[model samples]
Target: MTEALLDEAGLVRWGRSLGEVAAREAVFVALSGPLGAGKTRLTQAACAGAGVSEAVTSPTYTLVHWYTGGRGPVAHADLYRIRDASELPGLGWEELETRPGAVFVEWAERAGDELPPDRWEIRFEFAAGGALRRVRVCVRGCAPPIPDPAVYSAAPEAPSC
Candidate 1:
């Protein structure tokens, strides 16, 4: 998938949409964007859509935030303060390769050659007022296994007509 730009609300909507797409294919998202791009907001919206009910925030000091509710241990990482991007593998980066939940990384560009080839690359930027995010959800190499729809289903069915 190529890059597509969107407004702030559109970015949030895109997050929700990406969650839906990953609902069937465990998604490991890497949020790549500058400051004030609404990366955390987008992540929050996506997680909420996927069943998370807690407050999502940046892990600047902590480095990583694991949210468990509906997505089942969704992890969010901010590499902005990372000293050596090559140290990712040692930080359990391999987990995202085969998980159902997403591992959103802000400032993923710092990872350089460390990032896998299949994870989603979400790039966010500042627009006129709010923000604009361009997303490229690609799952070709790492192939993070897709989770069954029933796992993230909200309402379930009312019986087929």
Candidate 2:
């Protein structure tokens, strides 16, 4: 489940595909990337791919945003301001695992080990040459092997109706 997507369009295509696969697990997705590297863009695309009808926005200032009613609820969180894992539980981190919907966390590196194990680890890479970006998707703990970020494959089955 690893490869290399080229530009914005490629990233969106891959995001949509990944979103479809992610819908099956119904778990959380942690996005790791620097500012302005397209984390929110990919998230929005993924939500759309998951049939999210409402707007998908960055929860920077608010810390979290909730979207429900499409397939199910989607809890989007940006933990950039969080300094320690202790603070997460207060923001519903503990409930994330038990919640009926999926979750998407931005600046997940900040989550540290607090990040749930059974989830997608997505890292965005912006090459030195241009505005084009690359996204790498890997399961947690399977990290070291994914040396560089890659454009992984979708699990094949179409999204659930």
- Let me know the TM-score candidate 1 reaches against the reference structure: 0.70
What is candidate 2's lDDT per residue for 1-161, written digit by digit as tens? 55454577766776665555555446678888888887888778777766788888788887778776355567788888888677787776777777766678899888788887777787777764655765666776532332223433222345699
Worst 10 residues of 1 by lDDT: 146-155
lDDT of 1 at 129: 52
Give the lowest summed-lDDT range of ten residues in model 2: 146-155
Candidate 2 residue pairs in backbone clash: 3-151
Q: Give the poorly placed runs of model 2, Cα more than 4 Å off.
A: 1-3, 141-161
| Model 1 Cα shift for residue 3 (angstroms) | 3.7
Clashing pairs in 1: 25-146, 26-146, 26-147
